[model samples]
Target: MNQKLKKQDWTVRVLQELERQYSPSRWSHRMSADDVIKAHVKALKEGTEQARDLAQTLLNVPYGEGDGEKLDVYIPKTNSLDVHLVVYLHGGYWQFLSKEESGFMAVPLIDKGVVVVAVGYDIAPKGNMDLMVSQVRRSVVSVVQQYSHISGLYLCGHSAGAHLAAMVLSTDWSQYSITPQIKGAFLVSGIYDLLPILSTYVMEPLKMTEEVAVRNSPSKLVPQLKLSSSSCQIVVAVAENDSPEFRKQSEEYYKALEESGLSVTMEDVANTDHFNIIEQLVDGEYHLTKVHR
Candidate 1:
């Protein structure tokens, strides 16, 4: 394999081992119930709320009804926004965290008078990748429908969330008949390939077969979007202190998108880790300002 591909494979392996240790499935094996799915969801929800509660004074907004895929809005009460709706997708390797966890990151953007929606979704094992993605899709549709005045839809997602955000914007809106355009997408340390993550610990929850992995990966799908989308902005970001796997995907996907003639911007931030990198978006000290270009 070439140096780039070899590097990609090694990084994927490292994430797999880390995921194996932290995946909720590891906790499920000990629960020993036919419907351990609920148990897993409950635990993840508790953890997600704890993360959200860490931030003081967050407004819980139901993008959909009755806590069904709710998005937490953490903006200022001043109520001034004329730009795109900045929807943030939180990353827990697609199994943990929620809108609550991401609200902390949105605090600054919220304060910036930008409409920030931290989308929460069901995780894997209980539902699988398709269901997880479906929840986000539904949330976006609801946001546009419910908030009709919003002119544009922009996305920001970290890690696995970043991957999903990329997919959402890469969507062919013409096929969906959605009127509001997807203005731009910001993918912070997202994963775009799964070959390296397969067969490792993360796979149990992801249940990512080779076929599904290839189909979902943005690296594979971005090339096929030119027919439907030609003028979308994509910003692929990485922190200087992020894992090798994160850096690998951020840089690789950035290059791929740039090569495809998309307006792609890649940012490498200093002194930031994976979890805190999203903070830079709201803080303005981070590269998200660069990403907006």
Candidate 2:
């Protein structure tokens, strides 16, 4: 084949590999995709109950006018210092999950004298990427405003939620009349770029266009940080069993931030897949939680 044809063929193969790598069904031997999802929901339900019994919690506080624009706040019973806040956004490819599944990580953080906020936003088909992004932004601002005594804010997200968390890092805080009080962010198994996802089977319901994909990609949207000190505080992490594309995306995002003079750390989480990596947060000693602390 001619060199031109060879290059075109290679591009097609690369795209195919990306789709295969990202499709959770392809990795179902370890656990079925359906089971992985069920595990999350089960953990969330258990955690929600535990959160109520273990800590003082406020449920379904509205942050926006939308039906899903609400958050669950978990507060520790005992604390000697000004408590900080850790806001979690759950992932379901921006379509499948809810804030109800977000409380699984709350008990551990709350135990450390940190307030945990699990945010809810409308998912896809019913809600677009723009709407989800906006709701999360509004939720963050609302949380900060609601709790005036917070020492700082930390953002944690998994998968698509990680994408949204990265978007939060790029936010123009001036627009909301709020200072960027976010002290750090832990982005786990996230999709930083949506371009590859658009070509994958998952995008059918997301109905993403090239324009939307490019515009919302966190890898492509790293903002100029106002302070040098604030840049390095973000942590970018990927799991041992995460697909090659997922790991690559995380590395690429970390490089982009570093090259832009932003302070970012890249971590390889061992002995876990995409699903269990976030679940690790349920255990306080898990490296994922350590990163946040």
Candidate 3:
């Protein structure tokens, strides 16, 4: 075979491997996909309840004109103009989940006197990729604008939310007439590239085309140095038991950021699966939680 043909063959094999790797059936252990989902839902429910009980929360605050353009704000007792704001985007593969399911991680941050905003965006099948990205960007802008005295803004997201959070990093803030004072970013178990996703079962509801996939991929859209904040720190983390693709995505993204001369760190949360990785944020002593401090 010619060199070009060998390259093509290699690409085909890699694509096939990605499809197999993304299949939940191949990765899910003792629990089936349905079982994992049920557990996630239950955790979110409990977390939401705990958050409401622990913090002074303002629920369903409108950030944009759309129905899904809403967020839940958890304010700590020490909230002031000088306090930092941690904005979290919940992940449901851009198809499911909501801001309400995000508060479980707020308790620890809130206890440390940080404000937490759980952002909501329109989901897929009904909400296209463009709309979802726009909503997330708008939500961040809304939080920054509303809290004029905020000291620093920290962006954090889990799974699909991490992808959206990364999108915010690449944004041209000049268009919005607001330069966000981004202090740091924590992206947990995110999909940095969308190419592999095209071959995954999750693509059905996402309705992703090659163009759309390329357009929205964060790894593909590196932040322009002039637009990127110099002081902003970044961390990309993956769970120990996360699929090989998930771990590879985080590693690749971290490498991309570092090669671009950005201050970025890569973390492997020990002994965790996809679901519990974000759940571990509730523990202040965890390495993932300590990164915020």
Candidate 4:
């Protein structure tokens, strides 16, 4: 079978998994998109003190900020080293969390002696997914411009953040000339392909137009061009205990990247969950050790 054809088949499978598409009411529990968003916003408002403290530290690190969107840069005060600037994009499933919940990201990256940047953006409903990516790219480009010593940059995100990281890097960077210094990217348990979400109307606040969903998918984007092995490091790491749907999504995404002739790597984190996987991400070693290795 053709690789591209196989990908098309994979997309169909994702569509089948989406509840609203196959059956709307029961899946959504008769909740509207607004209802879902409100519930999430309420929970996030009660944030942890640890996250807030870490954000303050990150705000102090010196890195250029872009006016178009809000972001926090965490450059180790120590000075230049052959270090990777690891950018952490927070995931709220394209709706919820801020860079603060993932504050622990800065400590590990800095401990590894890498520069870290945690970007914040207006949540969806006010800004769509495209807007999210645009702001994230702006933040990344801003960092790249000021930090000439960013030996290699790594984009890492969780959940929805994972999706943004993947979408942002899937592009041909030279076209934008945003960074001549990108090393690679690590997308930990990302929803790189949105066919699943598209099957339901729940993602509409993302302003996920049909065209955007198709165009933004990493699996869909890789087939159209030739990318260099050195241009970027691509890794998709998913926890062993994620839902079968997510597991398949992870497999489908990595397989698409590989089949399309992209240099990619996949890791299944042992004994982890959708929420607990990050516990092991900062370890500096693991099955996907090459991410920091």
For candidate 2, the 10 contiguous residues with the lowest summed lDDT are: 223-232
Error of 1 at 261 (Å): 0.6
> Candidate 1: which stretches are off by over 4 Å?
1-68, 78-83, 174-179, 227-229, 289-293
Give one digit per residue, the lDDT tens place, for model 4 in 215-289.
777667664323533457678888776666667778998888777767678889877655546534444454454
Give all candidates' CA lDDT scores: 0.66, 0.82, 0.85, 0.63
Residue 137 in candidate 2 has what lDDT?
Answer: 88
lDDT of 1 by residue, 236-293 (tens): 7886766566677778888887788888888787765554466445445555654553
TM-score: model 4 vs. ground truth = 0.74
Candidate 1, residue 249: Cα displacement in angstroms equals: 1.7
For model 3 the local lDDT of residue 87 reads 93
How do all the candidates rank in terms of lDDT, highest first? 3, 2, 1, 4
Model 4, residue 153: distance off in Å is: 1.0
Q: How far is candidate 4 from the true structure (C-alpha RMSD, Å)?
A: 7.7
Better of 1 and 3 by lDDT: 3
Write model 3 residue lDDT over 77-181, tens digit each, in one string. 873559888999998889888887898878788778888999989898889998999888888889988998888899999999999999988888878858787
Model 2 lDDT tens row, 165-246: 9888777776886865788888998998898788787887789899988888887766534341264388989888888888
Candidate 3 residue spans exceeding 4 A from truth = 1-17, 24-30
lDDT comparison, 2 vs 4, better candidate? 2
TM-score between model 1 and native: 0.74
Leading candidate by TM-score:
3
TM-score of each: 0.74, 0.90, 0.91, 0.74
